[model samples]
Structure formats: structure tokens, C-alpha cells
Target: MSYISRLGSAFSKSSMFASEFFLDLYMYAHYCGISPFQDRRNKTYYKLIIETHAIEKGLSLANPRMLFGRKKITEIMKAARRYGIGSNDLPILMATGALQDYLALHRSAGLSDPLLDSIDAFLKDRATASAVLGSGGLRHYPDGMPSPSPEKAALLTSRFSCRMFSPEPLDAETVKEIVRIAQTAPSQCNRQATKIHFYSNRERIGQLLALQAGSAGFAETVTGLVVVAFDLAAWGGAQQRNQGYVDASLFAMNLMLAAHAMGAASCPLNLAVPHSTERQIKIVGEIPKDQRLVMMIALGRPADGPLKSAASPRRTIDEILTIRDQAVAAA
Candidate 1:
């Protein structure tokens, strides 16, 4: 769904169909609205050809399965975090595949569904910020620069979300470095209720990777993973749902940034396995069955990938910040 200058501008409309099959599909989708001479046979060909190409292309687009299966989902997620589409696409792809969903949603609904949205949500600063945050990226100003010396700016600036990685083992000391950094992350009232388990041994790594893959990475990448746990007893008293996540996430970001500083690339993966799967990982890691699993981290040296994976797309500043009523009053 990319477009160049239209006919009579740069390339002729006729020229597009000759380029790539996707381009051909684009041309046909466009022509469907204009051309009267087009027949059912031509339309059918466009449908069939585009559907075939889209599915194959989608698989190659950013599949983590190419690396290994759930055994390496962290690798897949590192790539996905860099490209947000990977996370969003998986469940959908898992549910309906690429083409079938596209046809039902886009083709049948046609161009209308895409362009029809008001796009107001996309235009909002908060919405844009949330999108970036959810995608594991930090939001920024419009001109592609961060506000001078803001929180998380350094972390976000140094992060590239990684595209590829080596199938190598994480050095024990390297794991220690990451653990040290994460342990320093602030906790509620200095509760310091978090603990980390480093698993690189093939036997243990295999179990953890399995839990991760069934959850959707298709494979676990690299040699080790860091399992972050928060003691339920740490927060004590009544704890809100958001508190658990917030405390964990704050610490998680600290760890990720620290990984980069220590000359390693890391991605935050999930523990989305079934209860049984999670139980297996905890036992293999010998966590004593008392602490709750907060999150997991995959770490290693990054691999070479398409485009270097450094160019991060971001929202405009005006698209991410706004003054609250109290803040505005203070101003």
C-alpha cells in the first residue's frame, strides 16, 4: 500500500503494473474505481494474484519463525518491537492468516474501510503516544527530536529495538550486568520486591523458550532469558492492577537501557504461556513457587538486518504532549 506520484506526474499508471505484483495490485485496485473496459476476468486475476503475493510477502515481511520457533520468540519480539506491526499482526495472523483477513476486511470492504476512518484518533497526541508506548517505543516531538533532556529520552534514543541477533549464549557476567541494572530500578516504597532468574543452560532455556513460543514468538532466540519476578508480598496491602504493571514496567525499562549500555541488545518478552507452561519454567529455574512472574527479558548481541533497524519512526511532539488542567493552571 505505497503510492508514487500518479499518472502524468512521474510514472504513468501503465508503468506501475509493470513494476511489482503489489504495484500491479495497487494499479488494479485503483483502476477498479475508474475503468469501464475492465472485465470480470481481469478483476479475478487481480484478486487471485494479489492475494497470493500478499500472503507470501507477509510471511517474509517479518516472521520470527524464520529464526527458530517459540524457542526464539525473544528474537522475534526484538524485531517486532522495532516494527510494531509484528506484535499486532501475530494474533490476527494466528486467527485468520494474512490474505483471508485482508480480503474480508480490506478487499470486500474495499478501500473504503481504510480511508473511511475519521483518523481523528490517529491525529491525537495522546493516542499517538499510547501507540508508541504500547509498541515498546518512546514517543517524541513532531520534528523527530526529543524534548531536551526528558525522562526516558536517553533510553529511547539509544534503543533501536533490534532487528536480528546471533544464536549465541549470553555470558554469565553479561547476565549479571543486566540483573544488576534491573535490580536497581525503583520499587514502591523501596520494597525492592523483585528478583531475577538468568537461564542460559540449554535444558532450562529450552523449557522457557517453549512457554514463550506457544504464546506466539514461534521460537526463542539466543542462549538465555532473564525472568523478572515481583514478590506479591512486596507491595503489601491493597494493590491496584495498574500498580503491579507500572512498577514492573518502570524497572523493565531501566533494565533494557542498561543492557544497551553494557554492550548487549535486549528485548522484553512475555510469559503468556498457559499456567502449566509457566509453572514448568518456574520449576526449571527453581523459583520456589512463591514469587509471581512479572516479565521476561531476552538478551544477546544483535544480528545484521534489513536497514540496520536503527531508524525509529515516531510521533510528533504536538502529537504526544498536552497540558493537563492542573499543569495549565500552574503555567
Candidate 2:
């Protein structure tokens, strides 16, 4: 090849790469929760959740300031009203619970602050919202951590993406147990932002599976659908933008494992759709607008007789691992 031809080809490749990188940035700018071009309703709800969680974190602190988060509480109230957050929304309920605990603690200590009076007034106006005060506040843990289990490897390797299922509907108690196990998945800063929505209705499962598009062959066998999502409000700053997906993915993996442990079959379904299709999914699935969908899970009891799954192999340790010790002793 001539030198000029080679140079021309290199320039063309570099230009194409640059264009693709900029396209990624453009998508991030428009779709991220912090973006101004994003939906206003979602943004407002995200702000409310973020502020509410801030209060929860403050309460959980080892040494929290008595009057800390006064500004945050004010912002929470503003966002709640701006977005018309329902009284029963978990974030609103938790915010009210945190405020109530704050008020009770300060008053019992004989402390005086104008912020307390404002909180008192706010709580009085929304008295109905205080129903969940017991559900959200911090709890005392007299006992320490539980011991680790010995069946880790057996449980992990035995689980697979189950495609065939029995027609029997999964009971409500089993679904709850699976979620309870999955909730133990760790998150950044103990935020616990993952949310699971389970649909046991056959018709609804079919509707959701239609949008997922990956469950075509086995859709008829699916008796339950699980939507795993993470609240975007639990994150802040540009650096933490993608953390929600990471946290939710961890939760989803745990959920699949939990299903397997409980003798229920589960297959992880991908939600790699456009923004418009995601909106449609949220509407059909009745998921909150501020939560980003991580993936869907098709759940059911395993069908009788021999079950079959693809032999999805893993790379050997050497193929997947890299070791750098002291930079090879400066060889």
C-alpha cells in the first residue's frame, strides 16, 4: 500500500471513532436523570427521593448533628409538593418518619430551634402521612452479624437461566421470600435503592414479556414476571451516574440465586430497549418513573421431567486473570 493511502485510512478510522464517542456523550446528556432535557416529572421525583434518603442517612449516622439536614428537609418538602408525590409514596413516608423521629428526639432533650417548629407545623398538616413512622426510622441492632453459610459454591453453580416452567402460579409467600433474600445484596453506602415489582397475573406477564422480546420461545410457560429497578435519586454527582445500574445488577443476580435456592425457576431477561420503549414498559408494568429498569426476571415453578439449558461455558483462570507484581521487578 502507498504511504498516502495508509495515512488516509488512519484518518478515516480516527474520525469514525471520535464520532462514536461523541454520540455516547450526547445520549448521556439527554437521558441521564440530571439532564435538563430529561422528563420534568422524573427529575422532580428523583430530587424528592434523593433528599429523603439524605435524611435517612443522617439518622443512621454514628454521631449526627441535632439540627443537621434542616435545609435538606425543606428541599424535600418543596420537591414533594412540586412533584405532587402521593402521601403513601415510600420516600414521602420515610421522610415524614425521619422528621417525626428528629422532632421527638429534640423535644425530649429540651432543645429549642425554629426548624423544629417548622417541622411540627409540616407534620401537623400532613398528619395522615405519619402512618409509616415506625417503618422507616433506624432500628437498634443488639446482636452482631450472622455467620456465613458453607454452601456458597454449591448454590451458585447449581443455578441456571431456566427457560421451561410449570403452568402453576407462584404463591405470594414464595415471591416475598425470594425478595427478602435478594434485599441483602450490598449497595454503595448501604443505600438499598433496589426495587422489585412482581407480577403473578398471567396476562400481565405476557404483556411485559412481549416488550422484552427475548422470551419468545418460553413466554407461554412464564407464570410470573419480576421487574428489577433502582431509584436514580439514590445517586448524585457525575461520577456516580452509572452506579444505580451496578447496584441494581447486584440485586438482580441475588434475586435469581434466591429463586433457585427457593426451588423456583428464573431466567434473567434483558431490557435493552430505547427510551420510548422503556417508558412504555414503565406504564405497562406500573413501575415508578424515577426508577431505572435494570432487567426483567421470568419466574415460575420448574416443569416436570428433564430440564435443558445451554452449556454457557466460562473462560479458564489464565484466560481471564492478569497479575502485576512489582512491575516484573523492573526487568
Candidate 2 clashes between residue pairs 3 or more apart in a chain or in different chains: none
Model 2 segments more than 4 A misplaced:
1-152, 326-331
Tens digits of per-residue lDDT, candidate 1, 1-331, equal 3354443644654444345556656777767833665675444333433333223232322342221222122232233223333222322122123222223333343444332132122223223433422221122223322122446666557564443456766678877877787777887777676677777776676677666762233234556677877666655323233365667778878887777777676667777567787688778888867677877877776543431232223434764688565445554
Number of the top-ranking candidate, with lDDT as the measure: 2
Off by over 4 Å in 1: 1-154, 214-220, 240-244, 304-320, 326-331
lDDT of candidates 1 onward, in order = 0.50, 0.75
Worst 10 residues of 1 by lDDT: 132-141
Q: Give candidate 1's TM-score.
A: 0.50
lDDT of 2 at 57: 51
- lDDT per residue as tens, model 2, 177-231: 9999998899999999999999987888888889988775678778999998989
Scored against the true structure, residue 185 in model 1 reaches a CA lDDT of 84
Q: What would the C-alpha RMSD of candidate 1 be, to one decimal place?
A: 22.8
